[model samples]
Target: MNKSSVTVQPLRNTQTKIAIIGGGVAGSTIALRFAELGLDTTLIEKGPSLVNGPPICHLHAGGNLYREISDEQCLTLLQQSIETVKVYPQSVNVRPTVIALPKTDHGQPEDLLPRLEKLRKRYSELVSADISNKVLGEPEDYFRFYSRAEVDALVNKSIPSKATQASDWLISFANFTDLNKLKFPVLLVQEYGLSAFRFAAIASLAIERLPSCHLQTHSQVTAITADEDNLGWQVSTKLQGNDNIQQQQFDYVINACGFKSGEIDDMVSAKRQRMVEFKAAYVAHWPQCQGLWPEIVFYGERGTPQGMAQLTPYPDGYFQLHGMTQDITLFDQGLVASSLQSAQPKLAQRFIEKIDKKWPEQLIHNRTLGSIEHMAQFIPQFSSAIVAAKPLFGAQQIPGDDPELRAADVSFHGKHYARAEIVKASSALAAADAILANLSECGLITDPAIEGYLTEHYFPVSQQCSDIEVTERAILLAKQRDYPDALAKNL
Candidate 1:
């Protein structure tokens, strides 16, 4: 008997539906992509707005902060950072980063030369491939070196009203930093800063304008199950204040819940190994400090008394600080992992309270002060800085329990489910592209227009919002979220 050939029908753009849980940067990026493609998509977020999770101040274009990561990881970060900046151009703080090593540090300044050269070459290649990819100025001017004598000379020079050259951005740091403590020939890389608030505003505005994408905020997912018909999955969610449950069905489900992505994994009985970490950055105001400063990184050992200290400058004399010591940015038992019983890693109730509610004033004071003193060792004037507002803190998920891991994208469980475990916000778009490719391979996306659009597209809706509009909305968002409005504005 000849077996009848099974007729498999490809789904149309309207027939294929996607449900993205968790409205953090990852979920928001995915929703934006699907929306631009004119596909049926639903984005469910438990928070009041999108991108309301962890602190995102640095755009690691070259992955220079973490010296332990591989060069491959650095290249990936460079590509993703460029794409992110293109998507949210208004959010980028166009300033160079000063990477300095104190006398107490073990690493040598010469050790970074190889990686810097590699990054410069790769950047040149990207620019050559496409002229518009030259976002970080010139590829030849990607990084610069300054000797101790050069820095000392700049201490007396006046700060540039608008920093055009690499040396122009180094005046403030050279004036404040203790020259005796740092190694010679410090590095100034093209790595810039990212405004989390501005990124959030742009993402929210772009998603709102898309009619095909439905955004549900202050909504929590309760349960999920495979439908009896075997065509899709059913998701149950409850509003923040209501107990009544509402259910929705989708052909494909994406778990992009950020640090709580493991919870979604557990709901579907999908066992996975992961870890969650809680970290914070404090805000301080130095009214007496003059001139614009670049983002400063004083490298040190992590989890020790002298961990890495980062100083991120904002407008209006406000600066964001992070000290990796236990008393400052890191807390006791702040990092936890999934156990044999469940895939969800348990964070302490206190940390969870900080994320869900407000941080106690005492805790904020002590931590902010600690971070100030930590930076004062290198920049004595920083000791006079006062706490500006509440610290930006949240729990971030790390896949496979390696806390030092910096590069990650997306993972697939089955044919119908995709989980995004992106370690950095810059990796969000790449993760979205992976999910889109997965849907195409599964025969779920059959639209010719969508296919042609995906072939050579980096960003489809880059010009959706004007700079003035993004700034106005981002400042409002920062104030509403209990942060200093300066945090939303670039320096």
Candidate 2:
């Protein structure tokens, strides 16, 4: 429980040691796997442990396991996450809720039905194959289909009328009925608290379960040098509150410093170019009212960038109204308040309205308003303009005489961007999920591996888009998609 002290030590010749920078889920999971494999591991964290540090990204452990990862990996992480929950019950949380497919508010009856059917089939297949326990129940009992009217009734009663709609309909599911079934502990439910809890619990378990591993905090690794004889790495770091710099040599280095991924790539080989930049934003939370909606609403265009808002329930008889805006300037208190007041003036007023409509005697007190500032400070932005068709499976075509098909070296942009590689928003999450799954499946960490593939790739990168173009496109798409619901409603 002690904080890492500021000290400098000279490099010492020692056995191969693994250095893991960043204490988030990816970094900690890798560190634990390395330690379990009998490697001398050191985990460097920029922040304090979960209990004291700010909230980490709230992730549905099961959701990430299911959609973002492979079937094998999903099962493994699910078991590991469950075990972590058992050991640290106070650090984990779960709720019974269904996750439905994205739906359109106004669409052809058949169009929405087929999409819903596809989602249902996929969900059933996943549960049958991946879920450990199986229970027979009606569709609504397990996962129900609600009409637009039904959805409206639920939201009007459960959520404030003024709040922005984040998504359509609700899918509710259950959690581990018995905490005793888990090996780790489960924490209280909060926004994005599960991912943070898992990160902490796994780190704690690794430190306790593996004696050879050491975790260091406030150590910023600035540079790395590879040893010639073994191609190992010599890592140099600047310790907080200390004048002397420290350097240590290790047989291997795992670069898990997210957002600074490009920086780490610079320290090692220069073959890999930094292709992504990250941006951060703020999420605001509003008061919860009785009869509030239970659906996970997503307000925004399908393809363009747009703000999102949702209502997640907490155990303490309170609902959390969560919203995200892309404009960083709107992240400030004054701007946020003004924006909300202007956009949804009735959001605050709806508390009284809801009380009058639903629970009459319930006097709402201690209306606390807070924001998850920098919950996920960075969302990745890829830098590529070219788009190529996905590789065809089982390809065997050779036009040897054609000059365009000649076997020769080709170059672009002074370096290859992996040849027609496409970037997507869900790529990072999918990759992380797969990595965790593999770690669990393999029973330990091995060489560097790439998992997860991008879908719905974008070109020209978000950064290259001129401000006017980005704004115009976003506005057009938002209107077309009825984004944020409120914006669409106003329009």
lDDT per residue for candidate 1 within 229-255, as digits (tens), equals 655899999999999999998999999
- State how far residue 213 of model 1 sits from its true place (Å): 1.0
**Candidate that would win on TM-score:** 1
Off by over 4 Å in 1: 1-14, 458-462
lDDT per residue for candidate 2 within 1-491, as digits (tens), equals: 22222121211222455676665544655554444434467877655441112223333333221232234333333333333333233333333232322232222223323333443354456456645222212222333444444433443333333324322213121110111211111111111224232334434543544555687777778887767763466788887777677898765555554434434555554333322211221222222223223323233222123333333443322223333443321222211111211211122333224322321222111111211221111100101111111100110111112211211111111211111111211122233333334333433333333122111111111113233333343334334422221111110
Q: Give TM-scores for every candidate, taking all chains together and pairing residue i with residue i.
A: 0.96, 0.47
Off by over 4 Å in 2: 1-16, 50-92, 96-142, 149-198, 205-209, 271-295, 302-306, 315-324, 328-491
lDDT of model number 1: 0.87
Q: List the residue pairs that clash in candidate 1.
A: none
Error of 2 at 372 (Å): 12
lDDT of each model, Cα atoms only?
A: 0.87, 0.33
lDDT value, residue 385 of candidate 1: 97
Q: What does the lDDT read for residue 279 in candidate 1?
A: 89
